[model samples]
Target chain A: MSAMNKQILLKSRPNGEPTAANFDLVETPVPTPGAGQFLVKVIYMSLDPYMRGRMGAEKSYAATADLGAPMVGGGVGVVEESNNDQFKVGDYVMCGTGWQSYCLSDGTGVMKLDPKQAPISTGVGVLGMPGLTAYYGLLEIGKPKAGETVVVAAASGAVGSVVGQIAKIKGCRAVGIAGSPDKCAFVVEELGFDVCLNYKDADFPEQLAKACPDGIDVYFENVGGKVFEAVLPLFNDDARMPLCGLISQYNMTELPKGTNMLPALMRAMLTHRILIQGFIISYHFNHLPAFLKDVSGWIKSGQLKYREDIVEGIENAPEAFMGLLKGKNFGKLLVRVADDPTRN
Target chain B: MSAMNKQILLKSRPNGEPTAANFDLVETPVPTPGAGQFLVKVIYMSLDPYMRGRMGAEKSYAATADLGAPMVGGGVGVVEESNNDQFKVGDYVMCGTGWQSYCLSDGTGVMKLDPKQAPISTGVGVLGMPGLTAYYGLLEIGKPKAGETVVVAAASGAVGSVVGQIAKIKGCRAVGIAGSPDKCAFVVEELGFDVCLNYKDADFPEQLAKACPDGIDVYFENVGGKVFEAVLPLFNDDARMPLCGLISQYNMTELPKGTNMLPALMRAMLTHRILIQGFIISYHFNHLPAFLKDVSGWIKSGQLKYREDIVEGIENAPEAFMGLLKGKNFGKLLVRVADDPTRN
Candidate 1:
């Protein structure tokens, strides 16, 4: 291991869309573990749209990330040294190591990863935060019943992909909306979605309506904006909407210009008896055990499939994240910080 | 008995706010009851805000009122003639007699009304549709917890008044919003709400915020224009919203001008993990038995108080309904079409 640790710190908040200048890559001395603490060599760092909210000074569901400090995130890491009995050297673990190459933790919220069970990178990917987000948001909030039509936006991305797959497993007609035709094809073919439509199509609304002939019963809201507008009129009576994220609006600086259509939206919701709820996965930690068991079984039986969009080097996280906001990444966006021993 | 049956027919659909010209007073030859059918002499008719939605040609949760047909509503009447084994002369019953002097029914949805139990008018007021709407919307959807602040709009109207009273029953701090000072006073003093703010006041939002020192935990949305704007910023984490009606926007012909603030609204709902669900009371008929028992008990113990805005004569129903849209009625609006034998 190197004596220097590379860290990406939030230099400033962005007014609208973020740029690389907002983040500063710095090198510091490798952190040492203290009593009951452990040092982790971060191997894979996750770059999610949620990190953009944390970078701002405004109070969100989660606390804001302090400027000039390492950006907050989760990662899969190798335990280099441990002062705690629960973790040992050479063991892999999932930790909130943020956007850093090396970090020190006191074992709180740290879960040891078993490499023999699944891939180590999955601790921060399909079998981790994104997977659990899809599990709870789709099952608990959306509650897709058998043979019901379930629609999800950002269909080829991390969370939406899992949501659609789970909907299918629950005997639903899973439909997906993606940015590109190729991604749509991948979602329908590889992910086993009933249908996948490219939201960028000129006839997106018509296409979405045609895809959901019986109307949408469960709408997994991931990317709001034009995509949401397409799904609104197709909602069936008693539809359930699990509002997970609005990635399309995350980078918006101000309220968009146009008529205040909230009245119309509320009317549609009321007329259909739709249940729209926003949820954060961290608030539902009690669901994690069931999520892990079911998802692991699905993966083992080849009932679940996942794709990763890996960007090598911690220094490239900002660019990769900016691409993620623009739908530039193909699947789950991640920053590879170090070489994986189990891979070779 | 009169040889003619008087009816209020829908003359035409209104563009924005309905006018008296939209209704026509018509008389038809009285028809005799068939076998297994009974004739009901309508006495007291209920006029609710939801009736406005039915007037429109557009499809809402309920079916639209047919053109040139008697306006749809609920009423209590005396069975003047009966050929059915279940009903006899002089028996009071609740039926969907609409806006008419007489209606014939075979008891599909008709319920026998005992004048000895409670006022027959209550079949549509505090002990009937409006009361059950409050009970189910507040308890089932709003889920108000003790010490939590619950805010209800159109505070002095049929649904809102009951919602505020029930919130008090559940040990929640109930804040109400009405259109005038008198209505606000009634909501606080008569309805037993913790506080009531007049939305017509210049500093309405400030007053609302002051009333709810603790952020709003549940918002029973009845009026949905300016009142909703004020409540949006005061929502606490895990807030629940029972979206019953948008009475304020029911008369709107077009979407309001200005910034499309849905993004901001979605952001608030997401940050708070708010659950906003729209529901129709008729869909929850199973709750009626419990609702009747609890509300009857409350009325007997003086824990529940009710006020009725009674307008005499069926000819005045059009003007009274228009007044209701403008928040002119003091309490539950009712049209005493004929003599209420149970009253004296």
Candidate 2:
């Protein structure tokens, strides 16, 4: 292994949309692991929309990433050296590797992964945080029932894809909304969604209304700008929404200007008995065991599918994440920091 | 018995706040009950905030009150005549009596009330709809835990009074908000709330903050304008909101002009994992039996107390209802259409 570890750090907070100039790519001497610690050589680092919130100095659900420090994230990697009895050399694991090629861990949240069981990259993709997020948010909060209609936006993305497939597994009519016709087709055809609508179309709202002939029962709220505005009016009485993320609004510098519509929104919610619950997966880790088992089984049985859009280097993370905010990435956006030994 | 049946009929739908000019008082020839029917002489008519929603021709959770039809409401009255086996002469019962001196019923939704057991007027107040609303919206939706803080608006009124008392019963710190100092005192002294803030005061928000040292865990949303604006900022992580009514917005002619705060609100909801569930009490009839049992027990044990604001005469119901929308009534607003024989 090289003596230098390449890491991406947050240089400054963005006023609105993030730019590459706001991040710093640096190479630092790899630190040796201390007593009861291990070193993991990162293979894949996850780039999620949630990271944008952490970049800001404001108080947030997740801890803010300190400026000039490694941007916080999770990754799948192989243990290169270990002093801890639980983790051994040559063993693959998933831990908080951040936006770095090499990281030191004391195994607090480290989970040993059997690369032979599934593709190693999946530890940072479908079988990891995103998958668990989809599982808990959809089943626990969304509570989709049989014959009910479940709608999710960013349908081709990691969380939305899993949410829709799980809706189908639960006997619901799963409807997806994506930015492009291609992504929409992939969601409907490959992922087995009942229908997928391209939200970019001029008559997208009308199309959504037509797609959901029966009003939406469970709306997995992922991208919440125009998509939510469209779904708000079409909600069935007693609708459940698991508010996971608002990707469309994350880059906003300030609130939009218009007629204050909260009263109207509250009215709609009350009249329909809609339940909107915001959840962070970390707080709901108690659901991890069931989520892993069910999601793994679904993947094996062809009831679920995942797609990855892997960017090549850690230095490219800032651009890839910026693209993610603009709906530029096709699927689960990941930064491949090093070669996966199991892949070859 | 009077030879004529007097009823208040909807003359027209009001644009915002209801007016006396929108209703007509008419006398119809007293109709004799046909087979399987009974005649009821309304004694205590319930005047509730939810009535305003039905008065509109727009789509709402409630059925629209047709022009020239008697405004819909529940009432406690005596069965004057009966062709139905379920009812007999001089038997007090609670049923849909509308705004009328006399009503004909076929026994559906009619609950026989015993004047000997409790005050018959309670069928529309504490032991009835408003009481059940507080019980269900608090225990079921709010789910307050011991030592947690629960906040409610319109604290001296029907639902809010019950909500705070129930929070106390569950070992929670109850904080209340009311429009007047007298109402605030009544909420604190009479209803056993830990604290009550008069919202009309200039430093009301600061007073609310001081009242709740711990952040709010459950917010029983009743009035939604300024009161809601005050409560929204103090919600703790994992706060649960039971949206029972938005009485403040009912008389709004149009949405207020300002910067759209929905994004900021959504961010707050997400960061705190808040659960805002809007509900209409009518659909949850399954919870009624449990509500009646618990609330009755609490009232009998002196753990819960109730007050009624009674306005005499059926002709005054329109004005009473309008006053209710403006928060003019101090307690469970009710129109006493005739003498409550049970009272004397």
Candidate 3:
């Protein structure tokens, strides 16, 4: 009755733009469930930009993932063995299972999923962290008002898509900046964004400025560097910037060479009276109930749409993650570790 | 009897730091009070850093001073003759009189000053714009808490001095940054700041870091550039910055040669979740009554102290103003256009 578990471990710390060499695929014994615990056979693993931050030793909102240990992440799984009364065998659950085919978890911080409600894999994507992140980061920090311009980067991805849709719902002009033409198309056409600029375009900055004629009111800052430089001069007085992530600069080994930008940025912030606040989504979980209620209704009513780029098998997690970092993946990126019984 | 009225006119806009050549002292016949108007003999001309912004044709919180016109500023004056019932001859008042020895007002924005209160010149400095600037910028925006560290630049000048004293009153450690050892001494010894660092010192950044043991919670940004660079790294999470002015960059012809500082500043703003906002004091005039009551009480109770650096005679204004920009003047820089009867 014994089975081997497939796991992806952090083989080495990345210098810049993490490659497959930084991760190792290893076989380990299936974890046994003790009292008040359960063994999960992970079905889906979420691949996110923040994982890059966790791989580094630098202090971030989340602690660094230890080397040669299972790379930290959240996953949706089926409870195969359980001693806890709250989670039974065959129960669908979402927990911090890292990048593994099977993981041991206590009932703490794990949420049970209902099969009839929606697709269970969504427990890690639009219905979970990314969704909540877009919700609070935009509504709470950006405070987008009717007719205001709301700009978000990584437009076709999980959080950015939701942010643009929500901005539309709030009566704002949702402008998106994505890495490719396809991503831009998906954002503007499918996600109902007013305009989506391709950051890869040589005229991206000019196009961005032309798109935001009244100037940007609420900027959801996910990508930093060039995208930010374009957005800076176009900021209207009293613009609010919700700085959720700096994905563009995550792989930068050293600061880019230039005149120090800190003074000019301060001058802009002062002149425009911009409110730039960086935040971790987990800290503001109190907005979860409201987010779920509103977003669920939107999805059910066809007002909100989501796309998933799911890769098959646990062994491909590292490659998929690298793709995710390079803006190669479209929509909410995930690794399908095992069969989702609820899906089919 | 005919008296010639002297006025300082803007000769031409300077490319960088303004020179005496930019100002022209011209004489014109003084006008008599018309219907509903009063004649003011300007006594104290307040020279502030924000005047630098008005000289340029760029859009700001206030309108640009017209070329070939008298330079715009606030002044404390005596109502020499009045046709308006609200004002009378020999009464001291404060109004936006520009840089002139005589001005005619309709009593629209003029405020009657009681000689019995503080000195009438303070109507432009401590009890006026600078006082209000410090009060609102610190209390409303910075929101310094007990035991928190508050840092302000231009420590011995009008606004910074008040900001430091107010931070002290709120039970926070007040650190001042100034250009010279003498200015630093006045800030620490006379204004009761906990410590004052001279930005002119070679080890200024190190000294500033050492001074802020708990890291900076509140930074009152009056002099931007190197002082801001020193403060940026020392900011704690959730630090609040009230960016009231950037006196250092006011005279710069172009941005200093170096790495573009905007990205780095944005990162700091995001990482620290800092709230940096620029404001002009006149916009927040709703706080005037409360400001007057509290500040006057502090001055009377010895909880606050004020020092005036008055340049005698109208002819010395342009040179005095240039000195004011270079951190040459101590305390609030005021040009005495006429005898202050209240002072004697």
Candidate 4:
């Protein structure tokens, strides 16, 4: 048990888009687990758009990550040592372990995972936080009725992919909005969206309008800049918008200028009786059992599919996270932090 | 059947705020009611914020007022002659007659009003459309739980007054936002709001922040320019916004350009799991009978109070409507088109 723990700590808050200089890589001694606690050697870490808010000083639902502290993130790992009754030394667990090689947990927020049932890394990706996010956000907030139109931005990403697939399962016409033709093709062909339109296209708005003839009934909002601008006019009467994330504007220092469309947005809402709601998965954990039962069944039946973009080393986490903001990742963004002895 | 009929028609569409040039008064001989139709002499015409949207060519929940036709409105009138079996000459009824001195009804959308139970004018005001708007908007959209702080703008007006009273009935702390000290005092003292603040005051935002220490759980939005700006930061997590109207910004030809706050609004919705829904009363008409029963009971029990700003003549309707937009009316704005023979 002489292994040293390497972690990434925030050196300072980013002015706008974060840079490597804003983060510091440091090595420290692995922490010991106290009574009723377990120690985990990190295997895979989940990178999400919500982490951007944690980097800012603004008051949000979740607390901002403190300056000079290890940046917090969800991770899937194996217990190296255990003093807890519910876990053993070899048990795989999912916990919030920050960007680090190892973490010590007291079994509060951590959940045990069975690697044999699904891919072990998926405990931090599709079968975990991001999957649950898409599940609750769509079912509870979006509530897409059969034969209705459901739209998702960043459609090839982890959450959006799950959202579009779930909408398809519910007999909806799933329309995906992505950044590139490849992502659009992936969303339509691989992910089973009824239509996929690249946001980068010069005629994206017109294309989206043509794609949704009946107008959008439910919009699973993830990327929220120009994509949202394009989608606004196409929203139908009584449209439901589940505001899950805003990856497009995460790095913005000042609010976007040039288009004051708030009044138009308000007018649309008033005229059409639209409902727009915002949610985080943690706050809606009460719906987890139903989510797991429904999503797991969908996966086993091959009705819902997911993909992962795995970066091989813990040191590459910072770069992978930065690339995520630019929509460079094709699927659930994960970092393979350590060797899985059980897999071999 | 030889009575002369006076009617107001739409002469032109308004550019921003409407003026006298937009309306034309025409006189014609009153025609006899056809089979299954009844004739009524218009008594009271209700002037509401929703009428403004109808004036514009833009699509709203209701059809836009057609050019060179009678300006659409809701009115309470006494049956002067009857060809329909459902109504007699002496019966009082409420109908969508627009701005006119007489009307013919097929008794489809019109409701029979009992002058014995309450004033017939209540059919168009507190015990009617405005009352239903308050009940459904607060209960259905706002969902004000007991002990939560509920805020309503345009506090002494028809819809806001009912909203504040209903919040009190639901055991929530009711805060009212108005334009003047008189209206503020009326909202607090007469309407039974827990606290009332004048939106015109320089320290209005600060005072609002101080008044709602628990933060705003529900905002019954009617005035949406500066009042919404002030209410934004005060909103608590999971706040419910029943966006009933946006009277303050209704006259703007273009969106206000100084600060674009849509992203911030979207962020607040996402981070806090807030629900913002826009609604018109007609959409919730199915719940009207139940709402009427409950609201009528509250009014009878003295648990709910209402006010009306009645102008004496039909010609003054335009001036009164303009004043209603400027917040000059103390309560529900109604124009007395003809004398109530039942009251005499």
* Top DockQ model: 1
Of 1 and 2, the candidate ranking higher by lDDT: 1
**Deviating ranges (above 4 Å) for candidate 3:** none
Q: TM-score of the candidate numbered 3? A: 0.95
Which 10 consecutive residues of model 4 chain B have the lowest summed lDDT?
B255-264
Candidate 4 per-residue C-alpha lDDT over B43-100 given as tens digits, one digit per residue, 9 for 90 to 100: 9999998888888897777899999998899999988889998999988999998899
Q: Which digits, one per residue and each the tens of the lDDT, describe model 1 over residues B117-195?
A: 8999988898888989999999999999999999999888888888988899989999989988898888888889988
Candidate No. with top TM-score = 1
Displacement of the residue A115 alpha carbon in candidate 4, Å = 1.5
Model 2: share of real contacts kept? 0.87
User: Which model, 1 or 3, shows the larger DockQ?
Assistant: 1
- Residue B21 deviation, candidate 4, in Å? 0.3
**What is the TM-score (0 to 1) of candidate 2?**
0.98
Task: Provide C-alpha RMSD values for all models, in order.
Answer: 1.1, 1.4, 2.1, 1.4
| TM-score for each predicted model, relative to the true structure | 0.99, 0.98, 0.95, 0.98
Residues A1-344 of candidate 2: C-alpha lDDT, one tens digit per residue: 76689989989998899888889999999879999999999999999999989999887888999999999999999999999999999999989999999999999988778877788878877888898899999988888889999999899998999999999999999999999989998999999999999988999999999999998999999788788889989998999999989999998988888888788789889899999999998888788889878888888888889999999988888899999999999999998888888997
lDDT of 3 by residue, B61-103 (tens): 5788888999999999999999999998998999999999999
RMSD of 1: 1.1
Interface RMSD of each: 0.9, 1.0, 2.3, 1.3
